[model samples]
Target: MAEGTRRELFTILETSSADADTVPDGGETPVNLSMDVRWFEIPFREPEEDEEQDEEDGERENGCRSAGGAEDTAGGRCDIILVTGNGIKHEEEHPEEERYYSVSYNCSDDSDIDFSDMEEEEHASCFGLDGDSEEEEDCASPHFWGEPDQVISIEPFSVLSGPQHSLGSDADTRDYFRLLFPDSLFEHMVEQTNSYALYRQRRSGKSDPHWHPTDLREMKAYMGLNILMGVNQLPDVDMYWASDIFIGNAGFKKTMTARRFEKLTQNLHLCDRESEPVRGERGYDGLYKIRALLDVTENTMWDSYTPKRCLTIGQGAVAAKGRFCPTQYMPSKPLKKGLRVWMLCDSRSGYCHRARIYVGRASEDATVTALAYRVVTSLVRGLEGKHHHLFMDSFFTSVPLMQRLLRDGLYACGPTEPGRRGYPEVLRPCNVGKLSPGEFYQCQRGNLVATVTRDSKVVSCLSSNSAPGLVGIGPDQEQQGEGDDNWTDTPEEGGVSFGVPRPLPLLLYQENMRGVDLCDQLRDCYPVGRPCKKWWRYFLWFYVNICIVNAYVILRESRGSVPPGGCNGKHFTQRHFRVRLAQQLIGDYQGARGMERAARKRHADSPIEYGHRLERMSERSRRCRNCTNKGLRHESVFGCKICNVHLCRGGCFSEFHK
Candidate 1:
């Protein structure tokens, strides 16, 4: 059976090979090979006859279509057993045929799947700072800032006025004024002195701060107005253009006196020392009728301010060579002033010191110093137990002066001038009711012996009792008993304690230590002191600039920055509005500098002229020869450069400036 199958399959292959000329199909062959053909039994899945299957798969001669039978392809799973059958051609109906095998395959394109269109969602979200994740429940939010080390690095900046300065309107600067001053700051200065002067000038009958004077009488008031505005920002400010102030250069000599001061209320008056001429009282120190002018303000047209105390001092002007007739009481007045009214010369105090030896105007240093001493003089009444400061250098450090301050119930502290005497050489130990000796040693003020001989005796002396057996080398380096410098030798037959004759320092002790060290140490014990560093002045300048800038900001509006509603609401200007912020700015910078000096110089020549006027007081005014020639001859120029006008620089220039 196997031999027959093999012979049949081999015959089909041999038939094809023997006839190489058969072109059975239209397809052409590219290359041809004629060779022997042998058919191995290849199993077919459709059960084709073995010979027919071998014929379908027989080798082509020149161009034959059949290689493996078309139906001979495997149907199901087929596994061919190579039992060394005579040929591969096989027919099988049975699943287990010896020459048959089973094979199966899925009809797929066998193509590779491309992931190019895989459609992955785009990446999102940053790397997490929010701690809201469930796994991060214990974690705190990460910080991006607020770390300590990042803040303090110095950044260099080129600072200057920016372009916004030009854009700054009167409205803007006015708001700045409100931001700076507020009512509280003004009230603070008001509690000190009651000398406030404000002038009103109306354009279209509407008053503005920029108002200037137009008349001779009002012009004098304007001068006073200008004076106050000038010094409002000084080291120790007392006067202001539109508020009450103390009348002084803020000198150390100022003493506080609480008396009912006369309200001028639009009335002008001279001091009692400057009364009407006594036919020969003019031109003398008692002759230049010092007066006060009051401008009445109608708050509700019902409130009237009356002059409370006015005392006549000396009759007749110094121009007429007048002498003060002594009096102890002041004149009482209930009189209110009308517009342009003038009160006769009257003094605020019964006894007065004449400026006979001094030249025209008061000096800043001398005046401020005098004011300070005056404060010390009145300490018992004005200061009580409260601390008071008396800032001073060594120039005023006299031992008697310090002792005098202590006697007045005020503490004393200050730097000492060099080469002076009466300082501590006594390191007397503390005893009795005084500090313990060890405690006294702990005091760092000084360690010299004999600072106060017999510390207990000194303590008793401080309690208003005179101490015995205590003496020292005086300021003159003489014995303690040697001093007319302590008190005047005007012997009154009455035995009264003027004061103990304490030694006065001729010159203060120059600092052996630093000025600041001395000042700090002294401050711990007393009220007066001085800074000792070379850079102290620089420190002072720093403080001064802050003061100046603050002053400039507050007072900037006083220079007419406040318009009715205050340049009212950004852009509107009303009755009280002024448009020139730059004018105010520039003026604030220059800010009436040297105005006092200039004013002083302006009046320096007046004293000589005043002397001449006083000498001729009895003569004639020529125009008002019979009308009491005491009337002021307005002699100066109070001019407004903008308006091109002038008014009296003296006398009653009050109403005119308004």
Candidate 2:
């Protein structure tokens, strides 16, 4: 080999000693290993001389040459040694190049390898691996291929055990029905509905006859009717009671007067409670009872309608004005006031999987770690053993949470704090400006992986399931730097521009994080909630609307009907669905209230009438069907020539005609 090209020789020691595995006692001398080896040589070259070397010289010098001259003093190989104690000896092989030698001890040798060794720089040298070959090998190893470093330098997260089973198949037609209507959910609802049974047991014979006690069946129906009416948004009780309006046909017994309706609403209760009549208290000391009812109903909805695939956590703001309103912060009014709620919703259907009201930091000891763990775990509690992916904002994502979730068989991806402890410093935002738009840095420690990409803005994310892969870029219209004026000149190609490339993590984040916002948008349209003095009443209305929205989503999917103009369906909008639900609930109670009366009455069409035929008819005073049914009286003025029925002239002349 060329003198300058061959630098350092690496020795491979093969041993036949049985005591090679044992370590010596601490107060000791370095152990000597006697080993036999077949010497191997790898080609190497100095950086400056590499360009000038001939290719023909490299091909002929492929194998080790026998030791010769002062340069090859050890037969082109050195004796292998094992060292112990603090000041172990190492040979100075080259005076020009700095070297650090790592010893691999597989055997104890009797031949001592001297550390007080030196070789002149001009002497013939041994060859080892070249830089290009070493780098290519390292890049191909999957263990630490794209990572900045091989070790997790920060404090490690507390990881849990893996789940015993896997998530269900990825097919859309998989058995998701059981999740939507579990038997446990039904059992809980039944228990809640029958809670009023305790009140009946306490009744005494001395109670007033006028004290209309609540029945479980009747209470449920009354609650259903109230939800229905709320959706319809009647101006007042009088409008619902109007005989001419369609709402008047909402079912009850014929004896159900306006007074009875008012009484039913005022006395409604889900369960009996201990009487503590304090003045000015909301619900007259029944607030606790109502709150309990809300809690049970909301939980039942969650259990009964579990979301299938991707879950997202987002915040919602409900406007309120009262001393009772909880102190909370929203992006719109951070210093001002509103009620805040954290919602976990399904990305596809926009159905809320779970929700929790956010009180101030005092109530929950609100650190980011504790809050994130609670919110994510509670929302995905029923999803154990199912490897669902969770998406969230920066407020609730951390390395520790990602590790915990992955161990519990759930995967999560979201923007998180790059500077937080345990996060890889290489993925920090401060290092992002050095990267171009399509470039990113990735690092992995165990199952947790962190990625930072430079898009229009720097995005840092931690994911357990996804890798830092690139899918493609978004359309040019969405690019931040472009303008409409730039695209207008391109007449033949239409006003379009190519988009910037996007990484997979940023794309997934954008797609999955809008679930809660979708829910907010749906509820905002045709809102059923009205202004109320009591705070809990707003929650009552809000939940009722959410249930309806969930039901509508299910119905749309099951019915398989396409709506025009981007409405829900051809025949049914959300309002129409609400009206139909109200009608069904009330109708099931007693057929629509005035339906039977209206059906039995004789009538004539305005544009088309029955043929006229003159026949002798009775002149006696008989009741007019329309007036008699509505509790009005009129004598017969003339007989209909067609059907021989009597009718009054002034109002009933055209009412029953020819």
Candidate 3:
């Protein structure tokens, strides 16, 4: 090894490491080990005359590239290096015999070895120092490296367990509802609400006359009214008890007074306000007001139903127009400004199994990808090792995250951004733009595969659960083909077709990624949300609506099947289920009427004399007010014309005017 000269070496080995101890003594014959011989070319060549002139002028090239640029017409001389293993005898008399070379121990200095002139196929020879004989060829390739005998094996997902409950056709709406809002939860709400009211009274030195300590039954009735309001909505809460004949609902008036409902709504509390940490404190929580409710709801959901194999992780927005620190502004979401919540839901049923409120960033130094990783890991905590296949979006998919999930025995697939770290450079969006529609380029490292496919747009995806290849038309595509002739398997020359081939991972993602969105859709229908100054109230209503949706889902699953028409020959939609649930919650409980109802009645009675007259009614009959007051079960086909009130005919009508 001279200062400026390159030496080309060829190495050979007579025996494998395992067979080294059985080498025979030098006497009889030397083993011809040509098949076991390994070659390595390390060049140590002399520089040209121009280089010597440049060296004299203080402009010398210091790297192997400069030395390799010189011509080598006459083949560089080769030197054979020998490796002698433990218990193996070497004889100097057989100098012409093929020798063993272990480049790992023999290459003492590599500063003088120039590799720039080596051919592409000879790159494998450079990694001889890696010392892995079996994987020697695989190490030569730039994109992949591992044991040569390694195989890709993905574990198949199997359902080891599911929802464990005895709920069957015997379960009613109340039973289903109770699963999510247990009696214990109602009692807890009662205790917290009372304590909060007492704390407020003590701080202000004035007691609220309307605020009486609420009981479990009253809480149930209050929640029932909220659910009813979502079903039969009105602009104002008092309108439910309005004296207007067209607008008022008698059922609401009988269930509870409008004043009592208002009182409960104003004083609702999930936790004691006094126990909350002050703002700017180290242990302060932005969602403290709703923390207890969120925790209980999430735990109940997890216990009520076990999610199926396919699960989706995504973010949903709970609309809140208020001054809150944790509120986020996502312009892309339908609800532009609101609180963001991360949810893990069952893909098939859209039932939410877990939810977490996004209260800003966890710390100042956390990056977006780091926050996403933490959210996913936290949501899927108990689900690990269950062989569940999780689907997510670009926000949560990354090479490292997918690899980490595969290690945990969880399968994951999602659309990934091309620029993410560790993504294969060969399958970058720019590099794969030339692929035809339905065609793709993929690179696999172990079980994780990164694919770039051409669809309407260039899409890049990473998946640990699905193999990399194009799949035939799926069920959804087949349905589309039925409606449009252009969706046929073979398209006409110039016709635009929707039947393009899709990568297996993309197909799975398309089919299962709507779980969170579906949950959001269900929650949005007939929403119980109302305008409130307190931000936590919005979150309260959000969870309440979600509970109803989840309860309905469980009821459907438990029942297994609905009769031909429905339960009792009526189409049982969610609206019907909610109506029944509210009725059960109200039950036979009765509360005293507020003073405002009595005054409104007195006022109405005063206006009765304006132009009172009995008038015949058409269409449906109503319960006669005069007969009901007198404890008679009489129907009315007539009412007072001026007062627009329904009453029994003859004696009953005349007596109402008096």
lDDT of each: 0.23, 0.48, 0.63
Per-residue lDDT, model 3, residue 134, is 25
**Superposed model 1: Cα runs more than 4 Å off:** 1-381, 425-658
* C-alpha lDDT (0 to 100) for residue 235 of candidate 1: 39
Clashing pairs in 3: 5-44, 6-43, 6-44, 6-45, 7-43, 7-44, 12-100, 12-101, 13-100, 83-100
Every candidate's CA RMSD: 47.3, 20.0, 17.8
Candidate 3 local lDDT, 275-326, one digit each (tens): 7899899999788888878778888889889867778999999988778887
**Residue pairs of candidate 2 with colliding backbone atoms:** 32-109, 33-108, 33-109, 34-109
Instruction: List, residue by residue over 437-540, the lDDT tens digit for candidate 1.
Output: 11111001111111221222332111111111111111222222333333222234222212121211100111111222221222122111122222112222
TM-score of each: 0.20, 0.52, 0.68
Minimum summed lDDT over a 10-residue window in model 1 is located at: 146-155
lDDT of 2: 0.48
For residue 631, model 2's alpha carbon misses the true position, in angstroms, by: 17
lDDT of 2 by residue, 160-185 (tens): 21111222333121112223333343
| Candidate 2, run of 10 with poorest lDDT | 118-127
Ordered by lDDT, highest first, the candidates read 3, 2, 1
